[model samples]
Target: MSLIPVDEALARLLGDVERLRTEYVALPDALGRVLAEPVTALRTHPPFDASAMDGYAVRASDIATVPTVLTVIGESAAGRRFIGHVDDGQAVRIFTGAPMPDGADTILIQENAERAGDMITAMEVVAKGRHIRGAGLDFRQGEPLLEPGRRIDPAALALIAAADLTQVPVVRRPRVGIIATGDELVEPGRLRTDDQIVASNNFGIAGIVHEGGGEPVDFGIVPDDEFAIGETLDRAMAGGCDIVVTLGGASVGDHDLTAKVFAAKSIDLAFWKIAMRPGKPIMAGRRGDTRFLGLPGNPVSAMVCAHLFLRPLVARMLGTSTTTNIWRARLATPMAANEQRQDYVRAIARNVPDGIVVEPMSVQDSSMLKSLAMANALILRPPHAPAASKGDVCDIVVLRHIT
Candidate 1:
């Protein structure tokens, strides 16, 4: 009858979270995936000490005087090394990324040199290791280049490639199956009476699962009959879904049969009825390989709970650190006194004179989605919170990541 405490609810919801086994995947398919193993360098970067610029490799001592003259020994371009050692009064013409000649320790820019019939003369002096990328400049063979749980990006992929990795071991994407229930709910484009609501929450939840890095498969909407819900759950399990999310009928009521259905399916109950507004009726459990999440009937409640619990579950299964840290901003307007429960108030953040301030949307109803679209963040209110003045720093959950 009362709201659950946020901390206790989080602990209970997170208790069953576990990572899946790892598998080797090609680099191209590895983007956005969490690494399952530490990525160690297979070979030294800049395998051979090489130039970092188009210049002439010369001994620093040989360019001690103004307009110093040195005979060009040979040319060095990328992948074309001039293995000849440099002698006194001699330089090697080298291009960017080219391996420096053996005896040369410094480089003089071509702009600082004058070409004279197969001979280039040094004009300015340089120091040792200058304009040169020494061996292991980026990474060394046998060194840990990336740790497990690191999310792969373009830069990371490039680094892996440079490490001579044709593929990488990564956590598998969580397969999330969505089942929407409610006789009044229908799919988009379907003819519906005024009493019948469009079954949009399931699709939206599926999309949210994808945004959270899980693969979502929609099982469509089912009538409020016990057999229909059971059938959908069966289909979800047969589809090899790691998690089955049932929309609506999660609370205690005549029509709320999701929890019963999940129980009948022999799911080990995790937790239900969190101490959070808009989504207090959320339920979680597990049936063998299938995890179950029963969301509230309210649309906004489903989304908020998805962000709070479902997203983290996916991240855990994928072996990535998960937390909605969008950077806290101040509240633009004073807030009302909160009840004994955590609240995720949908609000829009605007760049006002003070700073980036979040103002709660006028419509904070559980069923409203219009206000959700206009909101940039969800401001979190601690349980039994008191009314606060403007400029109170608060935690926010962004629909998108910034950094």
Candidate 2:
């Protein structure tokens, strides 16, 4: 089969994806989860007219003139109301958040008033309805506090709490089953032979899944045997995983049996071998309701592919809008021309006076994890593009903050 373009492959992968089921979670647990239903206020905030400052509640007509004397009736503190009316030439001493006295429409701040025993003199011309929070000032009952598809962040959580909502309906997080293949790979910090290398792709892919709001389930390592790979795929499917990702064994090598296992499990292959560097051998397919992705063995390639595909897949499953943080940046150094495949050059981005300036790393080998770790951005170069100068502007996908 021919290699698929990046855009076409991604479009096909996310075309008919449906959102997961909705579940209710506590307000505190709803952080970072996408809302499945609108959050409406349970009750009106500031159920009654309250004081916004520590002052005396008086009639607007009474404080219209400066230096007017008024008798102090009673005090209104938070959770305690005066209950009596403020007649003409009378005021009620009130603290912040206290219910306003009946017949009182204005507040005379204490800074502008002088108190002597039971009498207080207004020193300034106070405006009507000043320093008072009217009923339902924040929000009214039955009003929509947040819309569906909104991700609950810190501010959203506070707003929900203030609206008296104890729990919220949010889309369930997608469960991703990650399996690492190849006999040459061994778990980190474990004993291995001289020819074996530590397995690291699964950890990076799991991190990417978590950051994208999905729950990752590590299925451990599978050898080069076709039976082992097929059995692991069956187990993942039976475990109710929404997405199954296998690290390594995606290329056309003798030991590459992941694709064969996928075929044996009756998976409908969408496309394989994308027209992108470092991740050309990537494969995507689907078995029943579980999406399948076979990523390259190289650490950098696996991470880059996961960011490009898995992140957006999770977002689609959560019923949230998918957006990429791609920004334009000036090149700080010259770059050679590209070939038939598109290139994602790892680079460092810095904020300059004019705008963002990006400098591509000298070494961009797909197996180099150190360079990938140090990179905060990826300069996107189209297929068959010409060489670029030091000051040419290019699109960059932001990975993290430079600092």
Q: What lDDT does each candidate get? A: 0.85, 0.93
Residue-wise lDDT of candidate 2 within 1-403, one digit each (tens)?
A: 6998989989989998899999999888999999999999998997899999998999989878788999999999999999888999999999999999999998898998899999999999888999999999999999998998998999999889988988889999999999999999999999999999999999999999998889999999999999999999989989999999999999999999888888888898888899998799999999778999999999999999999999999999999876667899999999999999989999999998899999999999999999999999999999999999999999998999954
Please provide, for model 1 over 153-249, each residue's C-alpha lDDT reduced to its tens digit, 9 standing for 90 to 100. Answer: 8899989999999889998889999988998998889899999987779877988888777899989888998888998899889999999999999
Best by TM-score: 2
Q: Give me the runs in candidate 2 sitting further than 4 Å from their true place.
A: none
Worst 10-residue lDDT window, candidate 1:
394-403
Clashing pairs in 2: none
Clashes of 1: 1
RMSD of each: 2.2, 1.2
